[model samples]
Target: MNMPPTATDAIKDNLGEAGSHLKQAASAAGEAIKGAGSAAGDELRLGKANLKAELADSALAGIAAAENMGDAAREQMDVLMDKSRDVLDSASELIRERPLTAFGIAFAAGWLIAKVARSSNK
Candidate 1:
């Protein structure tokens, strides 16, 4: 003849099964949190690297613009010097063509300027 399990024995068996299931659930939860922390750290590292790359690109762009401006300023100075030489050549030609006239005009201008300055001072 077979005997049925007692009520106390059945209850203890159910408690053991419940405890095992709870332990498995707790382990799974811990693994999920660990994986999430690793993923977050990877994202933060990528963001920092991207920011550094962008800053380097911006600095390089600024340097290139400054170099271009410097080149333009040098070109403008060359043009100004060429124009100044042209003006000096014209003045020399005029003076050579009429030396006495140029000298009389210079003296007259100087005298007029002096008279005007002295009167203003008084």
Candidate 2:
């Protein structure tokens, strides 16, 4: 004849199985959380590195553009100065060749313009 299990024995067996299941679930949850944290940390590091590179590139580009603008402004000033020198030299030559004539002509034109302007105001 075989004996059947007692009520206390059955209860103990059920409690042991429930405890094992709980332990497995907790271990799985811990592993999942660890994996997720590592992934997030890696992504954050990569993003920061990319941002740094982009900022560096932008700063370099701005510096290059500023340098180019400076060069262009300097070139334009040189051209303007050369043209002004040419014009002044030409004027000097004209004055040397016809000093008295140039002065008389300038004085007469100025007097005539002044008189015309005064009459117009009236």
Candidate 3:
């Protein structure tokens, strides 16, 4: 004879199925959380590496700019020094050609400087 399931037995079976589903859902949720945490860590590491690379590139660019400026300044100083030497050479040649005039110019310049100094003190 075939017997039908009782109400209590049916309820117990349904409860068992629901409990199994719940456990599977919880396990899936835990795995999803772990995956999300690992992905976030990977992204953080990648971002940090990118930032460091950018900083290094900027530093290299700054160094190149500074070197260019230094080179330009040195070239300008060299030009100024050459001009000063030329002027000094010309002055020396003029002085040698006209020693008497040079002496008179020196004496007048000294006298003027003394007069200016005395006026300023008063």
TM-score of decoy 1 = 0.52
Off by over 4 Å in 3: 1-3, 74-122
Question: What TM-score would you give candidate 2 relative to the actual structure?
Answer: 0.54
**How many clashes (backbone atoms < 3 Å, residues ≥3 apart in a chain or on different chains) does model 2 have?**
0
Model 3: per-residue Cα lDDT over 9-28, one tens digit each:
99999999999999999999
- Highest TM-score model number: 3
Instruction: Looking at model 3, report the run of 10 residues with the lowest lDDT sum.
Output: 1-10
After superposing candidate 2 on the true structure, give the runs of residues whose Cα lies further than 4 Å from its correct spot.
72-122
Encode model 1's per-residue lDDT on 5-117: one tens digit a residue.
Answer: 89998999999999999999999999999999999999999999999999999999999999899899999999999999999999899999999998999999999999999
Give each model a TM-score.
0.52, 0.54, 0.56
Candidate 3 structure lDDT: 0.98
lDDT (C-alpha, whole model) for all candidates:
0.96, 0.97, 0.98
The whole-model C-alpha lDDT of candidate 1 against the native structure comes to: 0.96
Q: What would the C-alpha RMSD of candidate 2 be, to one decimal place?
A: 7.1
